[model samples]
Target: MKQIQTDFINKLGIGAFAYISISEFCGLFEYVFENILIIIKTEPKIIIWLPGIMSLILFTVIVIWGIKKFNKPIEIDTRKVLNSLIYLYFGILIAQYLFIYFGTDFLTEKYSAEFDFYNKANKGSLMLRGYLANIPILQFVVFGIILLKNRKTVANNV
Candidate 1:
């Protein structure tokens, strides 16, 4: 029973790790592009490369940490981790859509005139944002494939 609980918790940890890794990968690019001028002005050419370098470091750290945590008493099962990751990915999207729906409704009621006008004009963009926010999940699909392919080596190393 305790082992089952531990494995459940570990799967959740792996899901969280995957989510954070995706976020970091997306954020690193976003930050670098957004601050390209500031980086160039304040630092050298090498500094521009720092974001990529830092992202690599962060990716390595997260992978290592995930492997260590997942390789616990029962051994690391890639399938379970993958399932957890998929569940979490969809769970977040569902929750986000619910929030957007309810929030939009509440605000529309509160400020019917103002919100109605803006909402009508930006309806497409608002829907786009809702979908785009979860686009990071695409990267996680690649990550999942990598994990599945490397399961043998990962299990042995564990």
Candidate 2:
């Protein structure tokens, strides 16, 4: 068992078992497992086959399939790839925030008669903000900062 696990992790290089892929795999697995457990304990019949769990499982399957079936890998170095991916994610988040801020008049307009779509749009934007705010992106950013700070420790250990 140990050998098999070690072999699996060893083979799970940056290609298929990239950080994001592994994170998705673990997240979906935990979500499905915990959700099923909670449902079984409480309301087993309720939401047994909800679209959310199904979609998460499907996404996990797709990630695994892409990693296993496709043998492609990073053309550049792993560190460079990681750096680029992190920067790309940061850029995407910034762009999304900009779009969400200025893309609509909900944030700027007064709640007058002309703002008929105010309530719904405002609620949706609030929900979106809450969802984004709850994500672990900040945690990852902190982890990166800590890792950079402890770079000398890692070099010494190596």
Predicted model with the maximum lDDT: 1
Per-residue accuracy of model 2 over 2-79 as CA lDDT, tens digit each: 866654444444333355544454444444443344434433322232323444445545544543443344233545
Error of 2 at 88 (Å): 1.1
Across 1-158, the per-residue lDDT of candidate 1 in tens digits comes to 98787777776677675766455454545444424433234333333344444544455556656666755556557557767676766665565566557754665576566544543544445444555444445445546765786688666754
Q: Worst 10-residue stretch by lDDT in candidate 2?
A: 42-51
Off by over 4 Å in 2: 1-76, 106-158
- Supply the global lDDT for candidate 2: 0.45
- Local distance difference test values of all predictions, in order: 0.55, 0.45
Deviation in Å, model 1, residue 55 alpha carbon: 0.3
lDDT of 1 at 104: 49
The deviation in Å at residue 148 for candidate 1 is: 14
TM-score of every model? 0.35, 0.31
